[model samples]
Target: MSNSDSSTTKTNGDQFARKGMSNGHASGMGHATVEIQDGKTVVMDDGRKPPLAIVLKFVDVKHTVAIESRFSWSAKRPFQFKRQSAMEKEILHGITGSVMPGEVLAIMGPSGSGKTTFLNLMGGRALRGMSGNITYNDIKYNKALKRRMGFVTQDDVLFPNLTVRETLMYAALLRLPNSLTRSQKIKRAEDAIIELGLERCRDTVIGGPFLRGISGGERKRVSIGHEILTDPSLLFLDEPTSGLDSTTALRIIQVIKNIAQAGRTVLTTIHQPSSRLFYMFDKLILLSEGHPVYFGKANGAMDYYASIGLKPLIAMNPADFLLDIASGNVNDVSIPQELDKSALPNGNDEAIQPPAKDVREYLVNTFNQELAPQERAKLFALESTREELKLAISEKRLWSITWTQQFSILFIRGLKERRHEFLSWLRFVQCIAISLIVGCLWWRSKIQTEAQLSDQAGLVFFIAIFWGMFPLFTAIFTFPLERAMLAKERASDLYRLSAYFMARTLGDLPLDLVMPCIFILIVYFMTNLRVTAAAFFLTTLTVFLDVVTSQGLGFLIGAVMMDVKKATTLASIVMLAFMLTAGFFVQHIPVWMKWLKYVSFNYYVYKLLIKVQYSDGEVYDCGTGCQSVGTSPSFHGIQLGGGGMEAWALLLMVAIYRILAYIALRRMKTGG
Candidate 1:
């Protein structure tokens, strides 16, 4: 009998014998051969057939994979540096599997069995060294496959702020071929929605955290819908049934099966399954310890188990039975290392091999016999060539919306939010009420005595500390409320960080200017510091400066912290430091510590206000007669000039603080 290897060669040779039989000149020339050289096809022809006429088409796509390691840990180690120290632990051993066109393959394993890891590698999420080959129609696949295949991550990454239609539209716009028109894009999106059964709530918004919109199942569908809109030939889903009830899970699978029947390939990893769910898969790939235990027809799994002399219990789940058999081998129980065809007396082994008279083989043999004519025809019909798919990630963002738009949206949204509204009103009311009550107690300084100087000092000290807290309080409250939303919006590419920051800074200005001015004016009139309008304006400006400075500082802290508790703590610490170095109270500070007063917002505002108020009023002093603690000689330094230095200091301090706050706000808004 002819050896199969030699027979294959002879078959190949004989197949090319009739290539040029139409004329005698090309009769003997039909004999030609093709061989692969240097990983490329090289055709050879004796003076017989035309060398250029010899052609061979081999499918070039492949699914090459190699994963040696994977480590899992919690949030404590964001980079997982420690995990790299131990490289010997291979979470996923070199796993290799592939499916051709019209093939359905399933990966079955127990929980944490690296099934998800395998899927992640296929999706290009898990980084790993890959070997072997995964070819599609003779073409070697690469990252370009991302365009031809769809990946559904474990998490349903949907935006809480957008409706289902909006979410799908955004993804479609980003992923769809640029050549498609707007109407075509919308049509594609609508088709996906209908296919995924999201039409019922297409207009409903997706919800998360404080935002509420759609149900979880609908959200999941939206996630899948986004991917399906791309119309990829290969779809990889990670636990599509996770978090869904069995009924819903079955429905999802049915949808997937429908997709598979429509000439696309779909593969997914599923955990424990009900009997109905188990039967849904076209092929079963049982895995254990990152090794394939069995990969073949799912219906034959039970018989395969029995063939190994492991009898399964009646009515048992076939998958569970096979898993038990694999698990039983964990202790290294001995079994035959190879299949022995001679040992099968009933010829069952030969039945497992390709049947010589099978209809499938007959069809394949006939197709090969007619391949020459088929190719000649296909050469004219093949029109799939087009521009290469290139994913151009945009760097210029949609965040360039003007400050007015950003401010309007943020303020309106902030006002609608219970947390921001409640905190803002409470703080505002507190400021107004305290100003009124303090005004009632220390009304229009009667008899402006020497004791009034002490009162003025007390008033200045209280003003610096209270005003310093304004920025701190605003930051603590605002940061705690909107930090999370900012992060979410940034991730979704909603707006530019700079624009958002600018808008927010501007938005709080009206309130900042109003609150401080009101409190300062109320106090100034009540105590009646000095009647000049310029002095009144200076006093009010100091209060405005305090609030404006605090608002900026609050924004910086809020932007920097991002976390509520952390930001609040940081803001508190900063406020305390500012108060200590304000130089408004306990004027006698260590010389080394005095320099801190220069940079303190509180110090600048306090100094400027005192300068303005003193400039407006006259202080009686007897030359060389004044005695004060720390004054070496009993003398007043040249009669003090009631100067207007406070006005200039107030402007300078406000400008500096606002600038710093703006920089911080920009960073926070952009997730920098």
Candidate 2:
């Protein structure tokens, strides 16, 4: 830890920045460069409004991850693979840094050097087992700070169906403060679209693995657009250029530079960047084994190491040199005589170099003794004026709109995104194919005899049960698939959970019923169940009710499990029980299980469907004489159906089950 870079440390190479950037690999970028400028003049805050100048400081930030061991050690055995034990391992050891407005800080490290952990801790996303003090403008992290910050995660968690413009517009509506008018929010979104250079793909859909849409670079830009819609004072991103090409990554870093130039304090983690990309950052923090090797001006990193007698044999990318140092791949570099001898590893053999672990420790110890205290004291001694303090504590309204407006916005957004899924050709074909098969098998049954009546009953049973399971499986994936996006949006306080849930359920209601309506319309006429208009409409209503109730059950299970395999397994078990007690295959349920049938919504819907098409006076021809179908053993010898009561039961379940599902989601931990 040379720790040569301090808050006031200035590299002696500023005059040569242009000369250096114009040579070698940097020349390939042409005129596009990320050069730090002596910033423009800025005014201090008045008491009326928050300060545009924001400085974020993180002090002694340490994170220890609680790992559950797959194997346990106990008195019974030396090691047991079947048992588990609790263990703690600190992934981040007192990571410290600060960023001022108009500056971009890049955190570079080896794969497991806690780059992302440090970013999250500084961003307040990973809260558990973290001990640290993070402040904005010298105030501790609070709701005001939270509302003023934006985070773009490594993997872009975006809705594949939404266009880039719609994505930014919705973010604008949801994240901007309520003080802004609708026109103002729209203007802000438009500015973001223009600023992020997404004008060409503004209408492009953000496609997923199965879909082809925008290019990777555009997707990353759209992510940045989402965060900057509110013009947050601080922006933190996790590996914005992870998978892009060299040109694209440079463009992204340029965009981040532009953002920082706009007075937003920006911090990002880089996965091994090229020299041109490395030169873009104003500040840099190099980590190895969760220890800070260097934190200061990015341009001065090489000079700092050179002062400590560690220099590359040949000219190399500053980022690569730092990574080589972090990885202990420095055989080509010259080591200081004092460090080589006085800070030697515990070994008699001096010809061989020390291991990477020992090198990391040596750097850590050096930083602790020589520089950590000064930096720590300097960071701890920061103080702000009364106006700046008020500006830091000032909080904007988190939700931009009223509850009703939020629901309406989410409703329309959901509708636009879900239209293609529900109305796709594959879904149409599935519904049409199943309905046609059922219709043809019971074609024109005409119920004049007991045999035809029996076929009618079978058709009702098939359609009712099939639609029940269909909506359930479809709805079950809603929360699980969207868990990531939901968490991300909710963490930013985009909308209330109630508004989101209501929009999700009610918004999908119209789309969900469209296919079912088409299916029932085709099959009902073909099967010739009942010719009366009232009976036909009533039958459609019953199926719709059954579909809705089953969907609610799926929501419950999905919310509780939140995993596809586990939720599917539980759904299967539950539906199996409902079917057995439905009195379809078995007339008399076990006495011990008699109470179970009342809980299954299928029990009531089955009888109601029969009553909708069949009447009490209706009789079927017997070999000996005529007999009442309603009283016959084939009908389970139970009262076939009653009006109003069974539908009420289904309606009640719809409300209760969905309410419980929403409650479950509320309990879920969405990181901030």
Candidate 3:
């Protein structure tokens, strides 16, 4: 046999062996060999009984999407004031197409061609100012249909710290139906890993900029594996192979093609594919400046172009050729005077010039007048035949799991992810270093003299500031960095917003407590602020509350900003403002700015710490004299709000800020 045939035979044999091993037949029956010849399973005539074959079953449902739209989407401004000056950009201009079952439709276009926008609109990711009918199997797109569809965005948007298996397992737990047992959900995740050829990296971490982990191709497969774990009837992938090497890109596309062949509708936006990769698409949707230039079979695209007197150069990749045409690179192409331009909208006239139109406009006008009718007829025929098949829509449930279950899963996953960073050796060392520095700064502070008392008061205020500022700044990056992942998951309706917010808040509590406890233990005894254990415990409690409150503020800022740099900038400015009014830097505030203290978390933290340390009413010796602790000389001009009240205020701020964070997350979900 030739080498190619021999390699194929070996591959098949390995697959059978692995299957038998997985089915628990290999160990019991010793060694067995199986093969397929002429589409028939053949077993060797050995004395051993043939091992039972293992067959994996996938959801065989088919979904057809027919979408027609004239839509416009607005760009989101960083500041609301800029929105008034921003203009609405038209994306889709009355484009129409249908994706049938057992077919892979590739949407192709140049930069700013609205290819991704069109796909987002059909996937129900965009709903604003969209005027059109999008139907699945002749029914209007609804929550039920959305639940049955899976959308894979261009960016992977996964937790870099989590392993491949953990990521897919969490996705399965969240997206799969509640009727499925836990073992079945786990089996689904395993099957997805196998299907995506990710068995090797199943336990490898999905690395990001901070850490080295799996290869880019493996990460892409894991992303695909997450979406396919649910086995949705309709799958949408946006730029699935945009950044991979040519070989990896081809492999990814081949997997998608196999998915289509297994009776699912696959729609994807592909850019600048190779000739081999381009041919894998069963149908093509050519878009330019939000208009359809061509919608037909992938192989017939070249013929259609030649019919319009625009043949590509010999041996050119078809995708590259189509992109050139869409980008208006074709020269000397004449626009037919008889072509109908009246059907096109007048609003986008600026996008296309009059008299002699650009290449994209020419193709769009021609397709609408000549080819679209034929495509529409095919969709209509499919619609008419829908009655022949019994199509059952699964009953839609908003959440696949209960609230307690969601919180439990999310807590475990969040804890596992944060444990890698929150308690890292770097963070531990940093905290220890900060503690030693603070200890040495106020080494063995005493209450013997007024200057010493003032020094001790400064130390206490610094402690409050450190705890408040450190955790807040560190936690500010949390939500902004995960915004994309959160948006995608929320769009999928995986869990309730409250469940995620609570789990995230509660998961970080342990780490938040750990750092503050270490800081206080090292600093409190070294400074000798109070000798009593009760006093030290109260001081620690005060600092811990400050940390929690600061973390809550961070969550609010991160959720509201949704951009790491922007949120960090805002947090810095806000923290600086709080510190300035925190009763240490400025003793007597201006009457006009007195209101700043009420909103400042650091102000309350400082007050609570002072109360915990000085509430004993002890006496201190000034440089030249002695004074009572509650006197102005000992306590500095700081107002002694009762420690109990200050602690309650800190707790209230935590609740308020977290509530606001949840609201911001919800607003992000609704596109408010």
Candidate 4:
């Protein structure tokens, strides 16, 4: 229904201009510009004026990590490994810089030089184990300050199944201030969509490797859009242009420049950048081995280096040259004789190049002695003249939405994200195929006689086992997969942990329960375990309890082990153990293991299914005559647990496992 030519772009631009005029979000000077981008029509920009906001400053920031951590542990004796106190290493050493409104600061360095670490400290993503003074508008990082900040990580943490519009809408709902009405929040989300020029693909899914959706460049934009929805004044991006092509990367930088020009203070870490991209930054901080080599105007960086007698032998990208200098690759540059000479004690060897480490040390020392003092003085002077730390945002609620609103919004988002897999064509076919096979295999399992009654009990047990394992396997991956996204949102103070936990755990119900209902309808009638309406619903309820309890165990295991492969493997082992000890597979678990059946929630499900279909002291016809169930060996282990206990036990397990999962998730909310 839409076209992608320049005329279409013009029309789209006009439509956006009118919408902006109506909503008062794009308050401006004049008309909008339109451009044709990659066969898609997009508005160039909306006329929004800059509203000066924040000035970010950090001083003497440092961070250290254990050199001999778990990765260094022995494979043969992993449990015996311990890190000595001496095995610590510094990651960021006395790094300091600042960026004010209407300016974009780019952090550049070689790998392991702590560019991202420095950015993380400034953005308030790293707290403990870090020594620093990171403040926004003269205020330290806090819940209120967090609400006004945004961070785009190196890896785009997003719901791959949700459309671009939906992702931004959910962020708006959860992250916007409570002062805004529902309609206002929705308006804000729509405005972001148009503002980002994502109108062409607004409804398209933000896909992953397996799912085809938005282009990588657009996906990156959506990541930016999510943070911008709250109208954050301070934005931090860790390599937003990473993995992007030259033109796309340049475009991304330009967009970020536009954001900075709108009175937002932006900081981003970038790798090798082209000359065109290099000139876009207002300021640059060059790091080397966790030490600051240079912190000054981006345009004057090369001039500063040249003044210090370090200049490239040939024309090259400024970013590449800076990286070379930061990496101690001064051999390619004409370094000052004073710095080039090494402490070899052999001679004043003009013929030999200094060691890389020596070169790095010189760069660090030179900056600390000359430029650092002046930079600090200027930033402090600016800070003194700035208004007081209070931004009125500090008194606002840390979380934007009420508990009920968060629950409902998050629930809907979860449902949308999961529907592609939960209600997929393949899943539908899988449910049908499995149910048909089970129904045909257990056809008309008559329970009139003693022998057939055992067969009926087998069918009941199989149903409980099937639903139990199905949901557990599926639910095990939920939290582990979402850990990164959860960490990012939590850092931004988007929503309450309790709100997210409840929404995620309970939101799965509608989709999780669908296939079970369908499978039960088919398998129950075909197996003929029970014929009456009450018996049918009771059986369904029993299986649902089994599912709920098992899912809780899955969540617990997943939350505890945030690795997908490890969590899935552990779930398999745990579920297998539960099934074996639940009295269905083994007649007599050893006395020491007898207590395990009580611990296994599967035992409860099996018990409830039997009670639903059969009464106490029930009898069945044997070859000789009607016989009591207690006299038969077929129902030996199942009957001993007694009746009227499964429901409460299963419900208890549900609560306990969910609570434990929530607690585990809280430990990771701060990304500790």
Candidate 5:
């Protein structure tokens, strides 16, 4: 061969060798050889046997999640302060199972059967009372292992304003490792969208109660896509198909099956799946009343029931039959005496001998005797393989991004979400409309009379109340509506709680400032209050500060109560109390109740406005005589501090309320 031809051949051979080496390493092979046989290239591996690849196209891989849990809870003792009582009911009782990669494990149970609780335990999201031992591929479950897993909650808690792509991209940014570059993160999010069949609605907004957006199924897929952005090895989904139609539900399960087939461990809670969907599950965990009725192969469930002398009627769906047995609706069926004596695989007769009374007892006894030992043995075998395998555990931080990155991403996301909320637009419109109405009502007020001065003061006080009460009441629903989403994300350790709280506070500030500006601009010029540029700007500043302070109050209530109704009711009561004692309505206060006004934000705000307008030696003409309004009877003993001092005081209140809200958010528990 010529020199150039020989060099070319050598280069081709080197490329083949590199490809073989990469494949060999991925399959856990120590060495590989590329050979030319029969004019064709062949790759041979010489090392330990390779694991069964998820499919011919995917690499050889395996991941197993084994969990054993017994959980219960404590409750507050009625009418007893600082006292607690442990509930007699058990949430889970010695539940044990193992889910392996390349398979789907379906957890099914009737309502209140601890299905969700068990899933939560496995996902490391269980409440404080949970007691469990969970291991991922022989590594004990911890924050590190949690990083390699994905959790999709039952409720599709997504940002209603963002498109499907934006939602996944943000999730990718927050959840993916720092090792991935921006382009890689974007690509991963795109891949997840295509993988979950969300391309059709990639740019579609995830709509909520008021916004027009994606369908329920599409939203559900987006939620799933959010978790899968990092391509986690293990995925846990809670009722993923819960409100979806049969076709969409089957499609979701199929996509999930495809994910498992791609070498990811998938465990999902399903409620009454169709026959086809039921068979899609590789393993089935049937739970009832906090007890495991069966934990074995999904396809073999019917046969297992037959083995226990409880054969379902022909053509009956296996899932329904299992549910019937779980619910104790099945009639007693006699077992053959000889079969009862037959030794199970574990050399135990417990499987053969049915319980004398409850079906649940019989099923649990049989599973413990016959299947538990085998499952345990399988788990041990899988764990034993880990000793020889070189498993690299990537220790990752709870948050994948830095604090600044989290704040930035979260701030941008919050702004986008708020932009789409109907209430947000409504608040803006309400501010403008109320401003116009108030300006029209107090049109061109002149301080020609002392009573006109009072009227102007009333208008100023009304402005304070409008700006303060509106934002405060509207902001009350902010945290409560998104509490579920917050809990789910926090449970997954996506970001710091402080980061989210701060981002939310800062993100809404721009809009908050803008709305008040529009209101004050229109009303300031029309109402004809102090015409000086300094006075107009000062009034604007005071009103903006007042609105911010009110919003801070809203945040506190929302965070502390975490329920819209309760927070709204509490905020209404508090605002009403503030209004009653604001010094304008009730001039003469009782001795015991005189200090209440000091606690009211409205009182401080009214005082600040009064000082800003009248503190500069302005005069008003009475019908009989002209007098200085600043030194009038209404202003006597009110102590109208300097505008700067009053501004600082309003700012101080804002800071205090915001700090308290942050504290409450930090102390609040996201999930049970």
Candidate 6:
């Protein structure tokens, strides 16, 4: 490899880059040569200029992948669904190309040519509808690698709550080893801050409709920093410079070029690069109608255009030039056929190396050809296994952080977030005050007669419904906001999802106890229920169970759905079913629906309230055959001690729901 001529030899991933490109591999490229006079630039074909750098490499597909799609309703409305029936139109036409390790490989095509689809395939974000052999460093496309490879999605997916530094730090901690001490992590985070030039406003907060965080550039840099923190070998950014000014865009390309020069691969799907950015790339891949028009070194890309009798103007983006050619926007220029060898520069006649048909075999042969047998054996010798790293990651999380950690963090964050919104807190306080005031207005109003008892039952029924819906309010509010951050951390394998769930569950206990405790205490005391110290405790316990169970239900919904609107819809359905089966208005429901009562959390909660409040005596009148409202004669076929056992069963039901919610929360976590 070292013995190759200067025109063919390229640098390995060693040493930093100088201004412009250090290699002279662009000698064969006619459009790459430039001249400078008194700091003014001029396009020239002198053949002595530097070649552009290569930032990434895509060798070849190792296996054939068959992609298929089907539709069920196409025949019913063929005209309406003709286009819809074929969701996938085979965008990438099984093209083969390689990008250099430090080059920006531009992928340009028309709107429907599958540019985004190709980018998604490269990023491993495509679903089962599409299939293809994608390899990185000769390894088949793996999702784990995608984690290390950052994809700046078309939309800037930034959390508006955190500052720029906080956002990057969180991403860093999640991706890097936790074994490093706090200071070490901070240093690493600081390094990224400096590299992306975000130090000016490191603590600037991001902004959104309800959130204020950082500037756009800072957010984008933070996104870039996240991928860099993992020391990723490759990066796939989609339209990174979009929505930015021309100057900012050029600067961003320069930064990316610097990043590539630092021995990492950075491939971005850009709309159009300025001339400056165009010169920054090492390769160009042009596509039309899902077919490759050209795939080669960037400097040589224009040469292919010139070969087809087309002359591109200076300072024009290569993508724009190619598009013009494809769309017939420019007159074609002709290439000299026979006299080019002698007429061109001396180095342009050098042979072009053929691309490897089998990347693995090529690499193997290269390795074998480069080293002696003894050196090859030594290189293959194993020093330490990846199991050690996994174990180390596991060990850092072995510390027994009790429920205290989760409860404390969640409670604090919840309070902070709730308070920051201000409107929600005011509404919540107002509702509690109003509910208490309403209960007081109806205090000691009845329970002496059947109609009076029915009113009391109505009150209890409303309370049960309210409690069942409590978690729904919270889950909808909190989950959507925090889900993105949690997902980012989980994708980096920060900690066990179980630990996060446990912490959240435990942390909310105190706040959960306080809020409902106050509400229940106010209503229980003011409404003039038979209030003994034991009765007060019992009622408070029931309210607490109600709130916790609601929270658990909400957590499960939020965790699974991630979308607040959908979660609310689902929670509403559950609440409605529980209300119907909970003996609200129906003493006898259908047998099938009766089975739902067993699983209905509202049923247990409301039934237990009746047993606790009215168990001692219901003031029976003249053998009128009083049936206690919301009471079950038997639970699991065992009569209550005046049904005190029923209260215990309700408690058990709450516990079970809490457990199931925890499981759901854990499953919602990212990496796990």
Give TM per candidate: 0.52, 0.89, 0.82, 0.88, 0.82, 0.69
lDDT of each: 0.54, 0.78, 0.73, 0.78, 0.72, 0.56
Give the Å shift of residue 501 in candidate 2. Answer: 0.6
Question: Which pairs of residues clash in candidate 2, taking residues 3 or more apart in a chain or in different chains?
Answer: 1-363
1-672 per-residue lDDT for model 4 (tens digits): 233432322223344435433432221111335333333323346433223367788889999876653434778996876664547778899977788776899999999889888888887777767987877667677666776778999999899999998999898888776788888778778877776667889999999989999987788878888887765778899999999998778767866776665547899999889999999899999999889999989999999889888898888888989998788776568868776566244466345556788889889888999899999998778753423333655545556778888888888899889888888999989998999999998888876677687777777778888888889988889888888888887788777888888999898877888998989888888887668898888888888888888889889999999989999899888888888877666776798877888888877887788777876466777889887665666665456334567788898899999999989887865542
Using lDDT, rank the candidates from best to worst: 4, 2, 3, 5, 6, 1
Q: For residues 233-285, what per-residue lDDT tens digits would candidate 6 score against the true structure?
A: 56677777778777667666766676665445667777767767777788666
- Candidate 4 minimal-lDDT segment of 10 residues: 23-32
Q: Report the C-alpha lDDT of model 2 over 60-156, residue by residue, as the tens digit.
A: 7888998877854678875655657788998888877688877999999989899998888777778779887787776666555667778999999
Between candidates 3 and 6, the lDDT winner:
3
**Top candidate, metric TM-score:** 2
- Please give the distance, in angstroms, between residue 632's alpha carbon in candidate 2 and its true position after superposition: 2.6
Give the least accurate 10-residue stretch of model 3, judged by summed lDDT.
52-61
Candidate achieving higher lDDT, 1 or 5: 5
Residue 74 lDDT, candidate 2, scale 0-100: 73
Q: Cα deviation in Å at residue 480, candidate 3?
A: 1.2
- Which pairs clash in model 4? none
For model 5 the local lDDT of residue 112 reads 80
lDDT at position 353, candidate 1: 23
Better of 2 and 5 by lDDT: 2
Span of ten consecutive residues with least summed lDDT in model 2: 24-33
